[model samples]
Target: MAGFLLWLLLLVFCWPLALLALVLYPIVWLLLLPLRLVGITVSAVFAFLGALLMLPARMLRGRPV
Candidate 1:
């Protein structure tokens, strides 16, 4: 993979920072995981509500809602 090669090159060129990233990436991902989940949940809830509110009009139009 190009991405792997890029990181491998970075590791070869700058081991300290690359290693730091390797160590910290998961920590950052874990820290942000809850926020990502909450965002997805909120978006889903809003989408469901919107579809529910639209259903009556869609039915009136005979649109096969």
Candidate 2:
């Protein structure tokens, strides 16, 4: 019984720490998520556009565009 109560008390105290970590995850992700998304989008857009712009030149060279 004493061991059971100690286990229960440990859980009661530890649960909040776990809960706080869970709650903070979204906030941390939200803060950094946009920068990651925007970086990917910008890089992709630029790479695609660069490829398009270079395609004609590549074709003129009789190489794979």
Q: CA lDDT of each candidate?
A: 0.94, 0.84
Candidate 2, residues 1-65, lDDT tens digits: the string is 99667656755889775667667879999999999999999999999999999998888899655
The residue-level lDDT of candidate 2 at 38 comes to: 99
lDDT of model number 1 = 0.94
Collision pairs in model 2 = none
Instruction: Give candidate 2's whole-model lDDT.
Output: 0.84
lDDT of 1 by residue, 1-65 (tens): 99789889999999998999899999999999999999999999999999999999888999654
**Residue 51's lDDT in candidate 2:** 100
Residues forming the 10-long window of minimal summed lDDT in candidate 1? 56-65
Runs with alpha carbons beyond 4 Å of true place in candidate 1 = 63-65
